[model samples]
Target: MKLKTYDISLVGMFAALMAIGANITSVAPFLQVAGVPLSMQPFFCILAGLLIGSRLGALSMIVYALIGIAGAPVFAGFSGGPGVIIGSTGGFILSYIVAAYVAGRIVERSQNPGLPSFYTASFAGIVLIYVIGTTYMYAALNFWMEVEMTYLGAWGIMSWFIVKDAAFTVLGAVIAPRIYKSVHRGARLGRRSAA
Candidate 1:
């Protein structure tokens, strides 16, 4: 399907939002759990899918990842590059695409998505984010990093992340319908103005 300019712009906007979410911890170092800074990525990822649908949301995530891999300071702690992708948090970075797609796909199944749909889709996306991210972190720490954390231990480590993301997921769902309406209406107005 051909994407209108509005769609393309939303994709770029979400990509920029992802960057901002990743580094939000930099200015607030006290917002850490178990020595790991809390990241707002899951929130933005869900918003991207809920507001823009699957394809554009995933595209935005991909663009964000590429920018980081290309040495942009868009990742957590203002860090970036290929090394970040191979790091313990890399799985979480990669999981954003799938999470957004899954959330969007589920919500898109309904003709007119509502609060219930948003709740379901947001929760589903958070599950994928934690599963993929925790598993990869476990593998990276045990194998290359030589930290030797058991699978269960990895889950335990992610417990804090889970709590934080769960809250964010609910917030996203609650606010999404309003944002979706505003954004789509604005796009229509923009088109009419252009015409």
Candidate 2:
């Protein structure tokens, strides 16, 4: 479907949310696993997917990445620039797009994806995020950076975020549908008023 002004705004809003989520303190430990920092940005990424659906959700993530790469201090720990995108944690950053798209696609395809479906979809998306991120991390470390990290070693790093992300998935499953319903309800009201 074509994007309306509201959809565009939501996309931009989620993009901004990604930035804010990345930089927010008290979210997660600054602890590094295999040189990657544990960050809660995935929560917002999955939230965007649930709230906005697939196309816009992925677009939102792309916007977030591009803005950060363009020198906005919008990444985790207030870090940004192409350097961050090419850094060790960049795989996870890029994986947000795929995670959002997959999660949103599942929900959008459903007649009414309630909490259980959202949880399942989001959990799948999270798994995809880890898979893609870890693979990329392995390649980047071994080939690009000459760091010599094995594939299994890369996945080992993801252990730090799995439990936390599982919790966030549950939280997103609960909160996203409520927000989605409210937004759609408002949209319906607005349409009726305009008509």
Candidate 3:
């Protein structure tokens, strides 16, 4: 599908949301796991997918990543620049695009997607985010960083985060459909009135 001005605005909005989600609470020790800071990027990323569809959702994530890489200070802990891409959490940042696309693709497949579809898509998104993020963190730590960590240990370190992300995923699924319905209805009415 071709992107219009409205789609571009939505993409920009989600990118801004990603920035806000990243530094929502600053970089507190309690919010960190294995030196990686926790952020709501997944929640917003999945929401973009649910609300806007796979292409625009992935586009928004790409915009967010690019902005961060350009030293916009839009990343987690208010840190940004190309160096962050080489950092441990970079995989998570990159995973946003994949997770958003997958999540949106799942929902788009349904003729009339309901709560079940949303839940499945959101869960899948979260799974992808964790899998990609954790794998990259493991490699970054063991190889370049000179820190030893088993694959299982990497997964174990992210257990708490998985729980937290699971909750946010459910929340996104619940709210997204309602918001989508409202927006769809409004758009339809606007067309009818215009005609």
Candidate 4:
């Protein structure tokens, strides 16, 4: 009734891919609130980290981005291709990779995947994503729009993004462990029955 080592690896890979798919499907268009457009993709980023661990979680996001860049219609609004990466949403899209990595690393290091710790990791990851995304956005605006963005503009951009991301983080923190445990238990049961 013992599962083979390779079986475990395969299961893990499957789980990672499932999470990636979930993330890709979860993507939404930028939310325009009070004249600021905010990217809300960081929710999936943190969820990927908490569920898949740092390396695999980050890899999932990177793979998703590459697939979209390679012309898969898997991105937000069913959009895809390299142009999207160079588009306005590019910075936020790129930040997902780092956010997942940071969250995964924090949870793994703390060795406490409990809800509170997971929430903290998710929040921290969101912060990291915002830092990178806002900075990139500012630079891109300057380069493309030919205007120096004010600090208030940057803060405004980050505000809606953070709000959406925080909502997702809270949902992920509450739901991910329950989902993981259920799936893992089911898989184990299946293995035992097979054995």
The predictions' CA RMSDs to the true structure, in order, are: 2.0, 3.1, 3.2, 5.4
How big is the RMSD of model 4? 5.4
Q: Report the Cα lDDT for residue 126, model 3.
A: 95
Sort by TM-score, top down from the best: 1, 3, 2, 4
- Which candidate number has the best lDDT? 1
Model 2 Cα lDDT, one tens digit per residue, 111-176: 977887788778878888888888888888988899987788887876767877777778888888
lDDT of candidate model 3 versus the reference = 0.88
lDDT of 2 at 116: 77
List model 4 lDDT by residue over 45-82, tens digit each: 67777765677677767777787888876666667898
Alpha-carbon deviation at 44 in model 1, angstroms: 0.3
* Candidate 4 residue spans exceeding 4 A from truth: 1-40, 145-147, 183-195
Q: Quick one: how many clashes does candidate 4 have?
A: 0
Highest-TM-score candidate: 1
TM-score of 2: 0.87
**Model 3: per-residue Cα lDDT at residue 47:** 94
Q: Please, what are the lDDT tens digits per residue for candidate 1 over residues 1-195?
A: 566788789999999999988877777778787777778899999899988888888889999999999999999878999999899999999999999999988888978999999999999999999999999999999999899889999999788879989989999999998888888797787677767
The residue pairs in collision within model 4 are none
lDDT of residue 26 for candidate 3: 78
**Candidate no. 1 TM-score:** 0.91
Model 1 ranges off by over 4 Å: 29-36, 188-195
Better of 1 and 2 by TM-score: 1
How far is 36's C-alpha from truth in model 3 (Å)?
Answer: 9.7
